[model samples]
Target: MSALTLAAPAPPASAPPPRQLRWLLRLHRPALYAWTGLVVVLGALLLWLGGPLTDASEAAWKQYNACGMAACTYDQDAILLYKDVARYTGSAVLALPFLVAAWAGASLIGRELETGTAQLAWTQGVTPTRWLVAKLALPAALVTAGTSLLALLHHLAWSAGRGRVDNTEPWYSIETLYAGGPVLVALALAGLAAGALLGLLLRRSLAALIGSALVTGVLWIGTFLTLPHLWPAVTRVSSLRDGPSGSGITVAEGLLTADGDRLAIPRYCGSSIDPACGSLFDRLDAVSFYRDYHPRSHSGPLLLVATGILLAVAVLLTVVAFRVLRHRTADRKGAAV
Candidate 1:
């Protein structure tokens, strides 16, 4: 019997190491450049005309701080800048960069699948995990940087305006735009997860974009409008001016207005007026008057809870997506041989 010589089977091809996939993330720079440019321009404009911004906030906050007949006063133009221009505009600015980040995140994997490029990458020794990580790394960094920059800008603008207040207006201080910490992180993560989910389900760049937009819109509306007030309390102060001590507070015989008008509420809770009302109007005399009004807001707690839920969902979905995409890629490669 002749000695049998058996040929060994060829080893399977391995994917490129994770590092090359990292190198691929450099493609996100172009979009970052454009967004940074816009932020710079907007910042310059706001700084130059912060006077008007401060004036506008003054007017609004003063109105919010007004007691029955005793209303606070401030420059209307400055109040406008702080309330209308700075706050809203800063939010809008922060939103733009995140929007771009969402589009990029959604496009990363989805575009490859849609265009058949992912298949090519797989064949070229790039594993699904490496490809996904590579694609996401740079964009995530850019988004974080962008958000930080926007937050800083908002802080400076708000702080400057805060200095002009006389400490009597309820809504005129800098603590109003307080949604920074984990809330922003949650929002960014939610956007990324939304993009990833779209990419996986749709497998088309345009479809992923649409999906991201829809998800983000729903999140914004749902968290801000519907969820916060779901549990309504007896007293709702929904404005910056509803703070503890920032309006005309008096301790006298009656609720005295600046014009010497007296006012009273039907029911007095204690020796002091309800903190929800003001401190100045707890007198024995009976009269009806709206205390200096500082409308309050409750957007913070609602946002914090929503942010936590979204972040958890994002993490779970991302893990599922990774497993599915990796499995699908491996299966396809096996069949192609």
Candidate 2:
């Protein structure tokens, strides 16, 4: 007869449920580190610009202004230093979206799909929907936080130097317009969505990268062309003798003839205050000079409108990506069955 002794039942396995976020963080540790480093570097640069750099630049500007074209000379190094820092900071901020797009298309999705790793992940208890969600959600949260911080810092730095630095960029300048508000973060999110969609559609790392960059470039160009028209521009009309007043983002400036038609200034008149220019203007019946512009107050509305548009695009792209993934997964399953 066999012995009736039975071994003690083994304790139930105590492992925690699988976490897609942990796996995601583990897989992209290097990217996580790189993003952290970028945020820290940019934050430090903005701090310096707002503090010591601003003080030095403002002081130098004051000295130069006080000199008033006399014997006094300003410090060339100080002037150059501020200009270089401002330019570099603006360029860096502007370049962040393209970097996000490149990484999202090449490494985030395309490489995994290209290598069959994404399919392998699907077989490991991760649904396609969860996989895509994890991928986009993690990066989007990090990017939004980092970019918002940078934008805040940039606004601080720019405000610190305003009115004090003679060469400071205007509020409506391209760099300032994008980096000083929420629009930059919105654009970055849009880039991420576009990259993910391209990666899913292309499934090739190099092609996805190029496609992502092109998409971002097109968005940037479109924004640049359309930004001025986002809000209703203020129009001012003055006699041709007086000219327009109060500087802003000029949409159009032309001569308003007595016949109520707008005509561009003649090329021959070229900033000359001569009698011939006056005669030409009179002959053309140019009674008033009209200027259409976006005032500084309009910046907030324009930015809000632009941000809303970009965010809507991003949401639409993400939805499309999800549908595409679902369709592809269903097709594969059907083929296998």
Choose the strongest candidate by TM-score. Answer: 2
Give lDDT tens digits, candidate 1, residues 1-337.
Answer: 2334565544344557555565455445566676578667766755643455565565566665674466555455554444556555556654752575357545566786888877676666676776777666676666667655655555566556655643322331222333233445566666776787678778888878877777766765565554434333232222212322223212222243446565443344323335544443433332233333222343455446666776786677678778777777678779988
Cα distance off (Å), candidate 1, residue 197: 2.1
Clashing residue pairs in candidate 2, if any? none
Cα-based TM-score, every candidate: 0.60, 0.92
Residue 301's C-alpha lDDT in candidate 1?
Answer: 50
**Best candidate, lDDT:** 2
Cα lDDT tens digits for candidate 2, 1-337: 2344655554332321367447865788799899989999999999998899889988888888898769787786887898899889988998889989988998898988999989887776677887888789889999999999999999999999889888888998877889879989988998999899999999999999999888988888888888889899999987666666547788888888888999997875633266787888888888877889998899999999989998998899899999999999999999999
Residue 117 CA displacement from its true place in model 2, Å: 1.1
Clashes of each: 38, 0
